[model samples]
Target: MKAVIRITLKNGVLDPQGKAISHALDALGFKGVEEVRQGKLIEIELNENDETRAKQQITEMCEKLLANTVIENYEFELTPVVSS
Candidate 1:
């Protein structure tokens, strides 16, 4: 099993890095770029075969360590790994 997690800052939170990127884009002549939000993606390969159990475990991982529940939100996608 494979789990992909996307962690992003919640609305109303200050994102200095995002602002910096937006400014850089404008400086590089990337016009019409108003705002930018930065995020992180985490990919995990799991040994569990059961989809239900894998999702549950990944959810726990997010809550425990993967995401900061205070100022960030996370979403995940699960996919089956095909063996060659």
Candidate 2:
């Protein structure tokens, strides 16, 4: 099994990195660009194949270490690894 996790900052939080990206885009003449938000993606391969157990483990991983729950929100999707 595999998991893809997305981590993003909560709304109303200052995102300096995102702001910088917006500014750069504007400088490069990307017109009408209003805003940009930055986030992180994490992919993990798991030994467990059960969806329920995998979700539980991924949730715990996010809550414990992957994300700052106070400032960031996290979500994950489970994907089955294809056998070649």
| Candidate 2 wrong stretches, greater than 4 Å | none
Q: Which pairs of residues collide in candidate 1?
A: none
User: How many residue pairs clash per model?
Assistant: 0, 0
- Model 1 CA lDDT for position 37: 96
- Across residues 17-84, which tens digit of lDDT does each residue of candidate 1 receive? 99999999999999998789999999999999999999999999999998999999999999999989
Could you tell me which 10 consecutive residues in candidate 1 have the lowest summed lDDT?
26-35
Q: Give the TM-score of candidate 2.
A: 0.97
Model 1, position 81: C-alpha lDDT score: 98
Residue-wise C-alpha lDDT for candidate 2, range 41-70, written one tens digit per residue: 999999998999999999999999999999
